[model samples]
Target: MSESKNIEVSGSVMDGMAEKGGVLESPTKKPPTEYTVYPIRWLVLFIFVLYSASNSMQWIQYSIIQDAVVKYYGVSSITVYWTSMIYMITYIPLIFPASWLLDKTGLRVTTIIGSFGTCAGAWLKVFSVPQDMFWLGFAGQTVVAISQVFILNVPPRLAAVWFGADQVSSACSIGVFGNQLGVALGFLLPPMLVRAQGTVDEIAADFRLMFYLVAGFTSVLFVFILLFFKAAPPSSPSAAADLGSSLDSNFLQSIKKLLTNRNYILLLISYGLNVGVFYALSTLLNQVVLTYYPGANEDAGRIGLVIVVAGMAGSVLCGLVLDKTHRFKETTLAVYVASVVGMLIFTFTLDCGVIGVVYLSSIILGFFMTGYLPVGFEFASEVTYPEPEGTTSGILNAVVQVFGIVLTLTYERMLESVGDRWSNVGLCILLAVGAAITAAIQPDLRRQAAQHKG
Candidate 1:
């Protein structure tokens, strides 16, 4: 009777019984528990970094070959400047919608959208170059700039999602470093590839080649991301992994909370000013160098190279230190103070015609200036924990874009009126104000550490 009843029991029911019993039993064997671990978060990070670099490469492409572009397209310097300025200008309005997209959807969807937009923009420029179609190129840049709203907002958020707390700052730094590297490459490559001395026809040819090369690279990266990029790992990487979702479901409430946070507001202002100065300087580097050293287009590129390289090194080093020390406030303050001093030196020495001093001061300034970005991003993350990192970072970047536009225009006009020397003097005053604001920020590292530990 027992054997007959056992045979009558369904295999499906038995399997359910086994599952509830915490072990599956069989006549001959018992199966072992299985667990899966995915550790390709770093690989995911690298993909986004490449995407970031590609997007940024487009930002300064026109500015790098400023004279050649101006000559080839038969445009005013201001019109040529708008090619890059349009990027900063467009970011002002689109960032809010972009933040909503990132928070509501996960990283994979948002990043893919950004990646496709970038590839489209790059290819559009490739077509635009052959005809010397200024409007077409501007339209392409506008599209690429729109993509930047997505790409630039991801570093801190990506670091949080993909890396453990110990490596969060370092990962964010690497991500931000990608953008800086792109800018460096953008500044260095064009001048070398499209010679200032070349004829209009020759310059136009080189420009077309440059766009083709960039578009090709961007397309490859886009394909890689489409295939391999995952939204996140299977398991949570850190205690704060879910913090973004833990925020109030009400979007307006979340924004209100973030605005009311004192530390965040202070850091926002300071970071904006610092990044604003950088935007002004980068956009006007060629003009400033040419004003002092005429026909030194190659030398201007070299100067950009040194400044960005030093800045990259400084960014990584600062990230490593923050990882170890978690000294967000002190590290930020020190960098700000150092930036002010370096900027002062660079400003006063610009017209002295001493190439060595200009190089030295600019490198020093870049080291501290660019280094502040990662620190600011990470610091804001710490201060605004439990609030979405994307919201905080996105808003911060939006504010920075506003500053960039304002300062870039101000410096451009000042360049016309007073000169590069006085324009920098105005910048140094802004830096001093930034350093003071940074000094006032008081982050709750203990709470942040506890949250990460949890």
Candidate 2:
């Protein structure tokens, strides 16, 4: 691996370097200090999990019920998807600013901003439930989308601050699990609660009820954040955790440095394409199913739920595998390529008119497709070992959203002009390119190298 640029995040100290023991020490080489893992970390993690799930639920809340939302909002299906697209749009510009806020303000202030934004957004949507208030709903969604910027980059910071080095990856996975679970509920709950076969007033009532449920849930989590979330523990959780970021590395400089790295750039390309396609597929999945199945809106949501639920399992399994194997490049390449295969199967199966096969193929697609998330995070961290995990991850996510916008547009265009079958074929070809890129990268596990030397 190339030498890690000495960039700091959240103002971590840059003076100390990792020694042979894998513990960073001061230049004076003071004797090791005690690091304690507080039980409160679980409470912190739990609240964050729910909070993340709540915010993410809003991301796909409407899209999963595309037919119903289009009618209730008196808008086009693309307009309904735009409700979800607002998330990608907001995330791109706000991620760095959010990272900077977390760095400057510590956990409490950041949590305040994220939690309030989430709760407020959820409730604000209630006011937009009336047919003419689509713009108002969009505004509320934009608020929640902005809050995600504060939330998505938090897992690494949380893990570093609260977990031992040995457990960082697992901690990160669990945090990500919250976000995935939220997406699952986004796919599952809205379809069940909101009615597709109802009068406009009846559908509006369903939307109102669903929005209230989410808003109530979000409000409770916001209170939990106020009561429990600490900025940091009284003591660090591990020796490595103790050696933290300083007010170094200008945010723009860090972005430039990350963009300049060839390996990291390749990662951005591969990860971005994989995630972008996943996002587009998830957003438009219902339309693809409806085109074939016709009026099976509930089953459309169920298919999406299967994809996400399968993805959650795949994510957990991959985390366990990487923990045991530490095979960053090999693991990522295998999963990335498999996702393409999964997509290929799903494409051919979608038009076969066999809903059962479609379900099975979704399981395969979701498993590797969503499974690649943590793998990408881990690989990027390895190659850019000493760079701030928060910044690297933030940039990585930003790239994914960029691809999300592009591919979602392309997929929608093709789905309209070419057909659902070929639109997915397009995704398969794109992911194949990503897989080849993944294969070409030289594996660098500098973080692990430092750990082994310890």
Candidate 3:
């Protein structure tokens, strides 16, 4: 391949050096040696993941204290729900802009912007705690939701920029795992901190404290990202790192190209369906539990906690397997099938009146459903090689957000009309469709080999 063609295909054209024949020297000139920049890359990744966790923790905060929030603000359930729902809704319009920003700027600038937005939103919520200021809380959530557009698009990009080829999938998984861990913390913490049985005044006090804690944590993360996160290493860590070239070149063309790729589109839809269902489930778990098992709000939180924890574990395991075996297609398909089974088990066990069975089913459901995320994310990046990671990931997330909003609204209506048991049945059908679609995704392993060889 001509040097420019190679740069176009691999997305790694170095600046100015391409004019010297090629940015990467021919193998005969000097064998590529992987650069090991100890501690710095890992430290940057840690800060990014922490920021992701904080964003998620803020997103799910109101949901965890759902009843208390509604009572405290004297608002309807729909109003309280909008705090979380707005996050997905905002992504619909903002994700493309977020992607463009990530591609035009670099990881540091994009992430710092996002971190600051999250910090500002968190503190805004703290101010919203006094009097009839529900609107302030909504305003804060809207800002945080906008920040999510930037934060969610960068994990795969960060992993590609910082980690070696062999570790890329694993690293991506860790980045994703941090978001899920924050979600798990979101589920576990709020219920414990803001007691359901407390008087309205007492509940409001606890809710205020929760907001303060999240705001403080997010401020600390913002400071850390500002101080430490680097855009990319001084030298490329792997051939995949060369793909960073695409981040700066042909942003519009890359979007057009991604839309036209067959595998990328299929993976986009399949991944969206699976993740949309996961988002719906996460957002509505408290309602789902309370619907069938009336007055079991705490149990709902417990179930959510188990699902998120199990899902995080599943994400790490899937990432490790992908790193070792490069079995993206197979792993994704298997996880989809597992999710279907778990969904079936959970749906059937919902009203069995046995708490143990319900918990077990939820754990199983979470492990597989949540587990499919990293595999799907990495697979999308692999199939759409040479595209900016932010662009590909941004499109993926945008699609998932669209699906999430539609499904969450649809399922909420179904929960009222069809009841929780049948509402879950609908989710199962969606999971099965997602699995069938996943089966059609043929990963371009040749592209994988070429990326590694570069």
Candidate 4:
């Protein structure tokens, strides 16, 4: 029952013989088989977009308005940071189980688990926020964070299950766009809804309103997904996608394949560095901005919005480009290097005292940095062809979360001891190292090669 087959990507006999939706394909099937793309695929994608946003909203809900949270909850700034930090911490343990569930139980069951978690977590906060109960609020966030394990890895699988080979990259980006949209609103909503200038009672009232609204929204999403979401279409959307599930059926074996792949290992390291630093920077943006521009709490929130909104555009654009070019390595390296330049500029401009310049810096930084997410996911699928999308995506997400926790702690320490200049400079250096690693990877483009044969 145990096997580690080295698959050839040239439309070999084994490729034609792979099982799809638990049914064996015709033996007469040959290279370049025609595939179907259902209209229902769009509907499934829409449901995914909604809940992905709902779940991702919790990632930065407290971090954007850290000042208000600290005052209302009567906690330290570090305690406020942990509300967001715990998401990364919880993800490490939960991802293994979540991936197992994704492989075993399939998409519908695993997806509903995330929707239920999001709904439950949001409502739980509605109960706790009115009381200024920080522990209860954190408990709710942990539940949401746990839900992310199911949600984050869904995009790649969603794309491959429903989209054609040419459209998979763009579909993956559109899927991730939901999460970035959640983050954009997460940045925009808190400062607009809750103000740090208010009294404790006033702050609690504002926070209460925000929680009730999100809770109601997630409640609606849970019902929608319950009725509509399905695991896969009637047939595979692409030739490569036919083997997507069966090849990854042995979850443990898939892990072994991905961990041992040289290109995948490099992609994981670079992804952790670039994306992890983005996580720390976003979660702590208010802190960084507040240090120099005191009393500009709302301004900090707006800047956060600018960062993600720009990233939303970048992600869509990057995905579209990759769909056409399939230039995985070139695009990834370009984005990573641009992210470093953007970071250095942001580091200098934070002290420039002009908010407009800061906004411009955030746009440049977020566009590529956030955009790099889809590129990384698609590239992972490419480098580890024939591996299940969920397993590959899950491992990629875990690496970033680990680095997210480490880099966040490191940034906090440097911000305290050496001040803003050095803290950001340090992030830039780590990113450069990541860029060099990315440059060194000579990916085989196995998935793209298979597409040509098919």
Best by TM-score: 4
TM-score on alpha carbons, each prediction: 0.90, 0.90, 0.91, 0.92
Per-residue C-alpha lDDT of model 4 across residues 164-259, encoded as one tens digit per residue: 877899999999999999988888898999978998788888988999999999999999999898887766777678765446368888899999
Worst 10 residues of 4 by lDDT: 1-10
Measured with C-alpha atoms, the lDDT of residue 383 in candidate 3 is 89
* Candidate 2: residue 35 lDDT (0-100): 42
The residue-by-residue lDDT of candidate 2 on 139-160, one tens digit each, is 8998999999988878777877
Task: Show pairs that collide, candidate 2.
Answer: 11-245, 11-246, 11-247, 12-244, 12-245, 12-246, 13-244, 13-245, 13-246
Candidate with top lDDT is: 4
Candidates sorted on lDDT, descending? 4, 1, 2, 3
Clashing pairs in 4: 32-454
For 1-454, candidate 3 gives per-residue lDDT tens digits of 1212222112231322355476554646654443443346678778888999999877777876688777677788767667778989999889988898988788989898999999899889888876588899889989999999988878898888877776789989999988898888888888788877788778778878888999999898888888788888665666656645534568889989999989889888888888888888888888777766777777788888999899999999999999888988899899999999999999999888877888999889989999888888899888888788889999999999899989988987888898888888998999899889889888686436755466
Query: In model 1, which residue pairs have backbone atoms overlapping below 3 Å?
Result: none
- Model 3 regions more than 4 Å off: 1-37, 243-248
- Superior by lDDT: candidate 2 or candidate 3: 2
For each candidate in the order shown, give its overall lDDT on alpha carbons. Answer: 0.83, 0.83, 0.82, 0.87
